[model samples]
Target: MSGVLEKIGQTQDKWFVFLDKLESRMHEICTAAVPEIREVFEQDRDPYKRAHGHLLMGLRGQINQMRSKANEVREEKIFQFIDGITSELPGHGFFTGSHDRLYTFRIACINRHNLFEEKIAFYMSLLNNAAGEQDLEAAYQEQLQAFEAIRDQFSCKQCAGQMTIPDLFFIATYVTCPFCQTQNTFIPSTGAQMVLHQARSLAEQRTAHLLKTYEESKPKNSLLYRQYLRSMFDEWNKIVPDMAEENEKFYQRLLQDHLNSINHY
Candidate 1:
């Protein structure tokens, strides 16, 4: 049972790594395609050319929607997989009650939340870029400002000696701070407030690492990047069998649901 538990722990680590790689590849595909897609729209002006341009835009939008659905499915699978492994391991109750398991789960949840936020940023960027290509300057500016504001808010919190309750609420708008035992109320900062410089630095480092991973995985040419992305999808499909069948079915249903919506649009 101990050996089985150890194997489950190892599997969790590998699955997380796989998710990281898959996400990096998806980002690479979208990032690389953006410029090409933009250029295609820019150089075409005739009615037929315009129609083709719209088709390309639709295709890109559909792909983006699919990617978002895929991420959601992946997140669900990740949590379910973690729970399953943790459930089956030896001395389940003891392990589940362990501080280490709790800490690991908390860390995983944080990382997953951050990844979801980043994916939202990525999608917004794509929309802004597309708007710019379409010469919708006003809409593009609106979205660009919104994205910048989000970045600034995060940056402001990081730079402050101590964040006010308002700032903490802004930084983590979705979750209550566990430290202050506060819910939706701002905690006042004292003059001698503790700095989160180390935590902020660590967060920045993780962002940089993710960016570096994407850069390294990116292909030098669009054709190659597209192929790499296709390969990743194939790999994921193959590995789904190794995962829980319920998770596999969930992802498939999610993909189909998203694709159906795209078709309707």
Candidate 2:
């Protein structure tokens, strides 16, 4: 290859060095941020979780700064490297005869951008790991068990009749008194209400194996994906029956969109 083309290749090679430096710096930031976020989360006392929110926002801000800097480097350096390759015009490489300079530039840009994205994900995962180490899961479970033990303690307000709150309810639900035939409002604790928000996540975890199979299937089988979605939604609806209609509509729309995309092709 000509000296100019070789220089362009070497410039492309330097992208690895740039990425290595960026990743090393991201590691340092995450090393400091992760433990700090975990400490704040562990010390969290407010029901509003303002401290946790602030800490998370601070970590996200650092991530955003890193992303922005990486983007600037890609725009200034990676593109400059590709432009060097493009500068040699129609004779720089074997594929030069095809006049695919734009495609070449696109491929190089995508490669570097993908590298940056992977690093961004790695840094973000560190924050997520820190949060996951919290005792919230144990708290949620303990609160749930306590509610279960005292579920029989509630009664009908109207007739002073026995009321059985047969299931674990996240929100205030109407419990029918067996003897008086009156509906009584049963309110759960704040921690129990958190289960309402966690329903979808719990359902997803239960059906993750099916979802994984659907995701790993080649040719992107809509049937497999739909099966996984149906199972997941079934579990979600079981957890929150009030949202079944809304969730079913969402499921149908997604299925329709998937089918439509296949047809449109």
- Predicted model with the maximum lDDT: 2
Tens-digit lDDT track for model 2 on 1-265?
4565555556566766777787788888788887788778778886556898888888778778878987887788777656665665665445652235346545776787797898788778777777663344465568678887888887789888766688778878888889888878888878778777877777787788998998898987778888988998998897668788998998899778878888887
| Cα TM-score per model | 0.36, 0.64
lDDT of each: 0.47, 0.75
Task: For candidate 1, give the lDDT of residue 127.
Answer: 41
Top model number, TM-score: 2
Clashing pairs in 1: 165-186, 165-187
lDDT tens digits by residue: candidate 1, 159-262: 33322322322122432443443344333222111112122222333244443454576443334433443343443433222233544465567556755654
List ranges where model 2 is wrong by over 4 Å.
1-22, 38-54, 73-118, 133-144, 173-183, 241-249
Quote the lDDT for 23 in model 2: 79
TM-score of candidate 2 versus the correct structure, residues matched by position: 0.64
